[model samples]
Target: MTSRRSFLKTSAVLGTGLLMAPNLYARNKKYIGVQLYTVRDAMAKDPVGTLAKVAKVGFNTVEGATYTGTQKFYGMDPEQFKQVLDDNGLKMPSGHYMLGDGMPNAKGTIANEWQKAVDDAAAVGMKYMVCAYLLDGERGSLDHYKETAHKLDLAGDICKKAGIQLCYHNHDFEFKQENGKFPYEILLNSTDKDLVKMEMDIYWIYKAKQDPIALFNQNPGRFPLWHVKDMDKTPKQMFTEVGNGVIPFKDIFKHAKKAGLEYFFNEQDICPGDPFNSITQSYSYIKKNLV
Candidate 1:
């Protein structure tokens, strides 16, 4: 099994003689984005056609995903891939990077993987690099979080050099109480303010019984990116359309400046129905209620 911390070390062969070509970045305001994970099935089947639909749905920004066997983006070289995104009126906002040398016990770093990540991202004109999610064992303890923060500071430094920034995305676990205080607090307190930033996953905060307003009040200007997702109203805790959920995004967006929100993307871990319809509804909610 590959450790979430490793990406380059998997004895897994890159059988194709392929090197990604670089393409210029596209800049446009109408392109509110969607994380590709939302349309995994669609992308897997027809990346070009599916991306065209995403643009028609009114999203111009996009994040990427990686599966166990495939490490490349949508199977296109970075250049070809960027051209595809730009042709569809979209740009890569961020990408989920599998950290490390792709090997167990590889004496490399999670940061090293990120260095390459930023390079690839820069090649395609991305402005932010984020650690998408933390897995169980790979999540080193609170001390490990601090250690991760150190690495992020360095990564942020690298990003800054390339005209990009580094951010950490969260799940419900970061809100867990540690000795009566939330670990998220420690992560926020310990990381260098200028070097590290956050991409708030609003749905996860709600799952942890935390309020986005209160979070904004406590740490203003710390969050710049957001995963604007919603939860179901039913007892099952499923994902639903944005406005239908319990989160008060209207109230949250009111304080966007103070919260340091610069960019946001619509994401749903699981949609109850057609993924396209789900995103269309999500986009409508954001444009009307939040943005």
Candidate 2:
């Protein structure tokens, strides 16, 4: 029998013709954004100035990565941050938040502070609030993931009432197996489809040796957000600028419709040089080739 990777490679090739049709390629006009975490240092120093630079670099949207203890966005209140984004012609459709640790108290319901995070995200004109990461302690067995899924569903209901959606962003750890089962699969199976969605990080999934196309095929329309980072060709597979790497982004993007991709952000966890320059490089490549 063929391996899953082999099957995906063959399917990707066979599906190319269908994805290349005029109607399909036309959908590439959706807004391209950058995850602000790429410029964390600059944002911490000066969010207003950083946002201005992001707009100047031709990014139409951004995904925020700073929202912790203070319950504020980049040192500014939600209203103030929204204004900064608007002034620079940028919009934040989604933002990352921690949902496991302090979010829920002993009662298993969302704490007041977590509710504030949800409210602030909506106030800032965000359409999605993503639970961005799962700490090591939070991941032990499949049961833990199932409990997390339940918590996510509850959080999703809170977001729904505020006219926003709640999603989960993945790194490579979710792909690790425990007792012959994948935690990623457990989360997908346990969570209600309407309640919790996924933000697929292409680079990490590739690093984990998983087939994105296969996941998309298995759970069509479940992935609404994508982190479009690239992997270096080196043995370590370090993160690299989009077009300078080995990932087949153009081919993967051809299946955006099936993936339910609403917005995609360029995110490089570590930049070799200036983050702004790195993001500009990725932006230029996407504009010239992928988009």
Candidate 3:
């Protein structure tokens, strides 16, 4: 029954199928991550249980939000925390840290005992440590921003020694014009590019009426991480599930390679109902639509 014509056609079809298989496998290989801040309450109550639930919901990575208060990851020391993450089959490649002023007396902050924090992060196998936020008291003038940029570079040097990258997470405030110049611009220009990279918060950039694409074009390969939270279409512009909001995530994700994006975390600062439900919804939408 093996005619030459039929066998040749069958071979061509099989070759086509084989060619398409690699693309499907590559698509499945993209990592999906979540910010633990989305489940703050549950983490506060029971971090291990919360992480288990997060893994059950199909998130392979998590970004930490709390550290300064206790100098620990989710109320556990670095070793214990890493074990919990391994137990749940999760990886934490990045975590948030406050600038020295936010909690002045904190032991493991960037300003106080930075070496210890960096060491702990290395112990946890983290590849990146982020300067989480700047308080109003901490940010005032361009001079202050320059000083902060210098500090970031210094912190970054410590991170570099540990084989970890240092990044800055931004809010809309950095875009505000102070002395006829954007502090964010100062931060980008003042720091050593290799030492201090950016964690572009897509939601906040949009909220500030800035274009993420433009930023990517301006500073190629400088943004190594992203906070992939979305904003609602309402006038209030509240946080919403990833695809449920108006952000063009598909378009944004298309430029991931150009932006040097290694990892991105879905974060919703506030949720309407159960936070786990919100995170699950976001994870589903992101997995279906964006990488």
Clashing pairs in 2: none
| Candidate with maximal lDDT | 3
Q: Pick the candidate with the highest TM-score.
A: 3
Model 3 lDDT-worst window of ten = 11-20
What TM-score, to 2 decimals, does candidate 3 have? 0.89
Candidate order by decreasing TM-score: 3, 2, 1
Give model 1's TM-score versus the native structure: 0.83
Query: In candidate 1, what are the lDDT values of residues 211-237, reduced to their tens digit?
Result: 776565455566778888988888877
Candidate 3 wrong stretches, greater than 4 Å: 1-29
Candidate 3, residue 141: Cα displacement in angstroms equals 0.4
**How does candidate 1 score on lDDT?**
0.70
What 10-residue stretch in candidate 2 is worst by lDDT? 102-111
| Per-model lDDT | 0.70, 0.82, 0.84
Clashes of 3: 0
**Each candidate's TM vs. the true structure?**
0.83, 0.88, 0.89
